[model samples]
Target: MNSTHRKALINKLGKERYRTLINNDSFPSLPNDIKEAGLLKKQSNLDQVSHTSESKSRQISPTCAEIKSQQSSHLGAVDFASASTYEMNLESEVVQADVVHEQNPNYVSGNSLTFGDISVPISSCHPYQGFTKPDLRYPQGDDQEDSNITDAQEVFEHASLDGIAAIFKGLVCGAIRTTSPLADGLKPSKASVTTVFPPWGAVDCLLSLDICEASVEPLAAALFNATVKWAEKSLHIGFAGGASLTIPNSEVTLKGVRDEAIAQVFGSEIQQAIQQSRIRIQEMEKGKLTTDCVSMIITEKGAFISLSLGLVQGLEIQKKLYT
Candidate 1:
């Protein structure tokens, strides 16, 4: 189909699916523009608050043998200054030890292969390249056993997105203090915003959203569309069974001028991607689900599945119902 027609089909599909999704909710749905704006605002606020309290990551502690299994709890008021920092003593003799070879260049011994000094001409061999080029095949002695013998083909593939992810993570963490908004009751500083959602709060906030369960699909569809550009080229998106989404990209590139340009150019595509991927939305009238919210199951044309709830906690509930 023509690009315009294809876009129209996508819009039609999204609207039909979204309408169906809203019908499942007891609350009415808001106009598309309004819903988008609210989500954007919430996302912005979440980003700000998340950056402020950045260190509260979930930690895993392990107990072994007879020791009691300890349930992990969030610790308050961590002692930031109590950490002990040390410098490396690179010049110490222990650190400076190196291998020494006593064999002479011209020495040729009789027991070359059986047990005595085997003098090989130095001119026939190239010099070794530092510590990394270890001669693993050298028969040292009876104690020298080949410890590792795994095939090289088993090594997993790597991607360039790894660098991109690092850069994105750094930007979010590094710029957290600057990009926050300044307004009434709050200046646009990072710390003020952080009090609400600490750093990396997006994951938590998303999980907490009580979309009617139907709109989750649209949200996933949008996010999928947004993120799939890299996956389309780098790795296969795999979905093996019931409701799973996996995008094997090194990182989601959403930062700086490059990120901004991408968003500007591909905003609609991203949104549509999310809309198209949704598979199911929970019904609201059953009262089993939350109001003014829609959860959607987004699918990747048989590749994978993810959930996307509405923009805010109860936005669909707050809007008017359209029978």
Candidate 2:
């Protein structure tokens, strides 16, 4: 280019544009002349961007409007007027709290169940002294001493004792069946409780007893004769004793029905035995009794307990058999 052409170009462009062209940075950082020319185009682009952003802001989320419309539709569809009588009543009725269980009659309720033991006052006096008793040891005997009891005597004694026991048991049963409340030794019937039904209870129930035999004259004499040989044979007295409780109303017998319950201490067999023991007053046999050597005690308790102590020494037995 010539100096004249360059001069004319510089005169066409401004001083600032001329200076910017002289500095010359890069393609994007254009010269002032080109930048000024494109300003209106750039402003048009900015206006398009602003319009796109405004359109986006004006648009609502897809879900929000739909959700609101759905909520209003649901509210309109509710069957508030079509509610059933039962549901309406239930809603109108008063709500009550849960009921508590009732207390037990047999025990304390709403309290601790722990129990404590009771302490009793003890005697402060000195402990009781042991009884001053005489020496109860048996005397020393000869080692060569032999028993004098024979086999025949032992057999006889056993049979007699067994017979006595059987009769005694039967007699008690018979008394239970035959003995009347009037004749029995029990006290007057009083207010009592019946165990038959506990829930529907009764206060009065009858209680009675019977005294089988008060006179033990035969028993004593028989005991004596039985144990006479024991003293002569063995040093130890022949002792055999035990206790038993017999309930009443054990046997059932009827002539019309021709029925009879098997009985432990009844029937014709037992009755025959009783007849043998039941001797007339004139025919009653009496045996000699030694007060010192013989000791007897018999006790009765309300037809329930019977205790007998039949102690007969050799001398007592001899007296009954011989004298």
Candidate 3:
């Protein structure tokens, strides 16, 4: 359809999906204007307080292992400052001693396998771009001693997951401070959001949100809805999802010297692209271009989804949702 129709469709779908999202008590609440699918950003005094405390995040942690070690050692009565300083020097050396490849460009990591000297491996966790896929299969012969072989995909997935975990933990803990509807009274944390969720899409929604202004609940809930819909619909590579923001009408206006001239021009190619997406274009009234907003709401069995893009001030959801 035309850009006007396409924009209208986007506004309609965003509101509809969001409506079905927020009826649950667990989600953050928003004002009624959110029903219109207007994605505006909101700033509050609570948000500023959260930021001031976040600067000290690095000091917020005593890992479980550290706590257990301290308890086991019975060092609560001992002078920790002196003991820690001495122990830290030794531990620092041990941690630093693990470093390799400092000078040797051809150094191979223990997790990596290389053929002879050139950087090719029979099986490598790090696959070279554009090279043949690493052979992950191993012989299953029982005529001799049996040995285990690592699954390449599993190895890589685990390694990648460590990084995603750190990111998710930060997002969750940070959100607890900012948006949980009970954050200010709650103490800050130096941990991730929730691992209770699958976490497959945590990075996706977090990356889309503005950390300075965005809270954890709305985007996190959006992520949950997106993932749940992804599974329920059995969608692969994905379905129809796109969004557009409203720009000031003056953006299209020419330098009208005291109403001397006025015009609105936009790329017709965008309109052509939408029409090409198999959407019907029954009517394209020019005034509808300025109307810019419409919305729809879908309900699940005994569940409703309420979305508030406007509540997320300075929120920017990309046009394409990539798998």
Would you list the rank order by lDDT, best first? Answer: 2, 1, 3
Q: Per-residue CA lDDT of candidate 1, range 1-323, in tens?
A: 45556444435544321122123255334445345445545654564455234313311123221111111132232121321211111121111112323321112122221101122333332222211333459565533322232121121111122222322222121211123355673633221111011122122112111122233333333333322222453432322243333445342221111223223322332222222222112222333322122122222221211123233321221121110
- Which residue segments of model 3 deviate by more than 4 Å? 1-138, 141-173, 176-217, 224-323
TM-score, cand. 1 vs. native: 0.14
Candidate 2 — which residues are off by over 4 angstroms? 1-170, 177-209, 215-238, 241-263, 266-323
| Candidate rank order under TM-score | 1, 2, 3
What overall lDDT, based on C-alpha atoms, would model 1 receive against the true structure?
A: 0.26
Alpha-carbon error at 290 in model 3, in Å? 28
Per-residue CA lDDT of model 3 for 150-254, tens digit only, reads 121111111122233322332222332122333675632222211111123211112211122234223223322221122243321211263322222111111
| Better by lDDT, candidate 3 or 2 | 2
Q: Which candidate has the highest TM-score of all? A: 1
The true-structure Cα RMSD of candidate 2 reads 39.9
Which ten residues in a row are the worst by lDDT in model 3?
Answer: 255-264
Query: Which portions of model 1 show Cα errors greater than 4 Å?
Result: 1-106, 110-184, 189-215, 221-323
Whole-model alpha-carbon lDDT for candidate 3: 0.25
State each model's CA lDDT, in order.
0.26, 0.26, 0.25
